[model samples]
Target: MRTPARRTAAALAALLLCLAAAPATHAASPHRHRAATLDDLARQHGRYFGSAVDNPELADTAYSDLLGSEFGQTTPGNGMKWDATEPRRGVFDFTAGDEIVNYAHAKGLKVRGHTLLWHSQLPNWLTSGTWTADELRAILKSHITQVVKHNRGKVFAWDVANEIMNEDGTYRQSIFYKTLGPGYVADALRWARAADPNVKLYLNDYNVEGLGAKSDAYYALIKQLKAEGVPVDGFGMQAHLALQHGFPNDVRGNIRRFADLGVDVAVTELDIRMILPADETELAQQADWYGKMTSACLAVRRCVGITLWGYSDGHSWIPSTFPGEGAALPWDENLGHKPAYDAIRNALTAARS
Candidate 1:
């Protein structure tokens, strides 16, 4: 019904309005915000951060984000060991360990060298070959020297020994014990300290959260070592727990006892594994468990910090280690924060305040 000139003017005005809004629509798309970095996460809620870091592609990004962030400490697994560090006798390799230490230092994060002596990750060559006591001693010395000397000032703490206790209250028979006897633990600590006197030494282990046979053994061993004036400085409680198993009966008391030993305690490698996809009840239980663990650490003066095993459920070792149980981290695989994370942050923040 309108004239041709009127129609043209109306159409032109509509076109102009559409063009004006195009830029704003583009800016509001989902991918506008930058991905959160480790520093961002730490500043929000983290003190000690860690990842097993199996993938090569993401290791650098993960490390930079974690160590470079406000949270500034790292503990390497399998990277700084005899098997990986010196796969061939007298032929040392620092490729993986070097990367971890370098990344940590770059971000101003304190590096904790995960363990000089663990029975599990030893190279087959070291285990299978027959060597005299002196030869074995020399090999041990060289492995420590190469790894420790490489990151002298950057590395702060070292787990001198790890998981020596069996669930049945006996020392798990390891090649070190089989070859050099129990004195090997002390000897190893002495050698590590001599190599780098500034590095704080610790004994790291799992299943020592409560007064069970495992803890009893660890306590007895430490008591003896203390009497002998061993240079051991701290204890690492690898609190790899599960909600179904229920929280340990006396975890806080156990932590307190360890602190009373005149040594610091750290909840290294902490994760609360849920056996099933967490329902409301399961999630609630995890929150309670996290609260208790954080409370325990808060109560103890020497409990320096707690580090979750991985940042998200997707990267958690639980699915592989315990099939059908994956959601064990504070954040799920897609980076959505979970109730467990919230509980821990709340607990830590309240305690800090």
Candidate 2:
């Protein structure tokens, strides 16, 4: 026997919970409006941005939600590789990468096929198997050929080589380097170009942003690649920056140096992770960093796009992989927009002005 007032309150509570539990509908509040849409962003900024997604179910909705938004492209987290594409040498598995590519194609979003070759997350068989340098080169050729041919035109670009330089401006001594020597990178690019003449190819790396020795090393490689007629098309600067360590003040000069080489430049994986949710000072610094990075690109004709690694702080790979790291995105875990989003939007929109 509940009092009439109590009964009414209980009914209201249940209704509110039901509403909260239901998946969002179009009529929903700011959540829907805040959800970043690809069409809206692309049309508004006329620039490209993207994220790496792993699941197919979320991939479909995320692409649909963003179909025509600021982010006009998408990439797979760990697909389009020897591990995912050809895990057991001869057998190839296109399940995950294909799902992402098809969804982006359906939504008319440009797709960037990440990492044809990387030192990390490589298949163990590729590392462990006793293959001669010739055998390895043959395997590399076949892998790139099949993967490139499979997704040909759908992928707007491919990271033909990744992280080849050490922090101190020397070759990182990857397996390709160890087995077949320095020419391995050129060989991979040649094979990839032959497989898909239309695909824009790039060399991606981190911590080589400013005009330092590392940057000089990459510059030499780019020049050599051009001189050798390797069909190289772009350079991807992995801008995984931080609040504590701060960004290189000469970011603009760094980017321009590469673009000056007659190749496209992209901030391939841009994120600024703070140890904690931003304080007032941190927020201002982040906004400034975002604006500066954006300004540099907008000023450069060949700087094509700026892609965030993930959409939100919650899903950022920083925390799990780099302990004590968090809050490295333009959105929070709840999908709430942050100051960084507005900062980037303002930068891009203002850059056009």
Candidate 3:
């Protein structure tokens, strides 16, 4: 016969096994229970889910497959920029950009033209050459007109100007600003509109997800642009967040204010990074922030979409740019979904409900 202690131990083991076999709550398995893709969930609320991708990442079968399957929209990370589109002054090359456009089309994904103008990554010829205001204006017009015209129908939106304002609400001393003054902003938008009237034009920037000097500057600028019929359609908030900096306190309010200005807003280039060696607490906090951002966008009708800078940590630009800081995406380096992924799905589901 078995002893009383042995009998009690057997009963406890059986109870533990029963608990392990039971289904987890929604809180525990947010992504596991959901069968709908993110795009599908967003569509119910009339929003698009997207990610930015570099040209090289397309070569990875697994990476590309997940990108094509999960997201409904894609932005070319570097292919459509001034440097890649026109490596030589007046000599345009669309090979890299075209590759991405074709891939997006084949996958039935909408494309967002990544940036017609920026201070950095200009071709050496343009940077090296010294030109008068008139010469630069003509070149700028040509570049914007041709680039937009070439990708006319393929792209639904364009980041016409990016990072043009500093944190103090002053224009950066870029060549375009120095040579042509702030008139370049209006000229760029008008030129793009004239080239393709259907494409939505946007001014994109980083660190403007909340009320601040930088975003306030954009509010005034966009208001003036709209009043003067400059064809401004949207503002892109590049939410390149970091854990240490803490989440923006007024992301939803910020987006609402821009939408009230009679233009759409997009959470573009979003990635939440933490310091090296991410732990469970940091990852859980990351998930909460991701859900908050998604809910913020969904709360605003004019907030059209949200796009991750890159979908996976393996290809994220964080490690290279911010050393000792990585794991900034919803997917791990091995393409497995991270907690942020479930958080996003749950957020979308909650929004739809």
Clashing residue pairs, backbone N/CA/C < 3 A, model 1:
38-65, 39-69
Name the better of 2 and 3 by TM-score: 3
lDDT tens digits by residue: candidate 2, 1-353: 75799889999999999999998756557665585453354345555767666554353454336433546777776767668888888788898788778767776668888878888877888888888899989988888888898888789899989998898888889888888888989988999899999999999988877778888898999999999888899999888889898688898888888998989998888888887656878877877887787778777778888777876775678899778777787877766777887887777666656
How do the candidates rank by TM-score, highest first? 3, 2, 1
Residue 77, model 1, lDDT: 57
- Please list the residue runs of candidate 3 whose C-alpha ends up more than 4 Å from where it truly belongs after superposition: 1-34
The candidate scoring highest on lDDT is 3
Q: Per-residue CA lDDT of candidate 3, range 1-353, in tens?
A: 76799899999999999999997666657667657788888888999999999999999999999899899999999999999999988899999999999999999999999999999999988999999999999999999999999999999999999999999999999999999999899999999999999999999999999899999999999999999989999999999999999899899999999999999999989999999899999999999999999999999999999999989999999999999999999999999999999999999998777
- Displacement of the residue 195 alpha carbon in candidate 1, Å: 0.7
Relative to the unseen true structure, what is the C-alpha lDDT of residue 272 in candidate 2, on a scale of 0 to 100?
Answer: 85
In terms of lDDT, the poorest run of 10 residues in model 2 is: 59-68
TM-score of each: 0.83, 0.85, 0.90
Candidate 1 structure, TM-score to reference:
0.83
Write candidate 1's Cα lDDT for 1-353 as tens digits. 76799899999999999988786656557666856443344344434544444325235464336435535566665578777877887788878877767766676667778778888888888999998878888888777776777767877788889888789888779877777778887888788888888888888888888888888877777777888988788888989998777788698889889888888888888888887867988887887787778778777777777777766676667898899886887777666768887787667666656
Which pairs clash in model 3?
none
Q: What shift in Å separates residue 43 of candidate 2 from its native position after superposition?
A: 5.9
